[model samples]
Target: MVDIRSPCILVCSIDVKSGFCFGCGRTRAEIASWLSLTSQERDTIMAELPRRLETVERRPRRETRRARIARQRREGQ
Candidate 1:
């Protein structure tokens, strides 16, 4: 089984424009691929996260709910 622990901090917020997790500095694709990555890969990503986060400018959390809605709608039965 893949380890599914989230890299999120309490920030729980995201930048809609960049689709980056504010707390963990990971892109949505990176988060999705986490399970398939080796520990070394994960560690490398983790190590680079701080630098990536430094480049991220804070934006208001506008797309959080929208993203959820879109995702749910896409997955709807």
Candidate 2:
């Protein structure tokens, strides 16, 4: 199966305040139509993710497994 480009880290919960995914920082509409979007479109969205994530008021209940791994890797580096 071809893996389309995605920022998902398997944390599939949405932040109610921002309407963006707690993990990938994408809205439900974006996530639902991701595969159908062009590379440029995805890139545009990806560029905004960090900023969008910062706007999330309510955080996830706990650290996601993928997030922990990424943190460990960054710390190790």
Candidate 3:
């Protein structure tokens, strides 16, 4: 068996809009069946991850420290 690496970053939240994991850029089905997939399949999915992640909305609904700071700076406060 080949040693296939997992793309999980431990940020398991799924983005509702894209139907992809916010961190790993994989669908629920894909994630669930990952271990059963062949190495070539895994590699193909891995190659598309960057493109998939680009379509995911990563912003938190609530205010974050980094966002707050950026906002304050923009407001010159």
lDDT (Cα, tens digit) per residue for candidate 3, span 17-71: 8999877899999999999998889999999999999999985345645557778
lDDT for each residue of candidate 2 in 12-62, tens digit (9 for 90 to 100): 788887898888999999999999998899999999999998988656867
Q: Write the per-residue lDDT of candidate 1 for residues 1-41, one digit (tens) a residue.
A: 56655566645465666666777888888877988888888
What 10-residue stretch in candidate 1 is worst by lDDT?
59-68
Candidate 1 colliding pairs: none
- Candidate 1 vs. true structure, TM-score: 0.59
Comparing candidate 2 with candidate 3, which one achieves the higher lDDT?
2
Q: Which is the better candidate, 2 or 3, if ranked by TM-score? A: 3
Per-candidate clash tally:
0, 0, 0
Listing every candidate in turn, what is its Cα RMSD in Å to the true structure after a full C-alpha superposition? 6.3, 5.3, 7.4
Pairs of residues clashing in candidate 2: none
Error of 2 at 70 (Å): 14
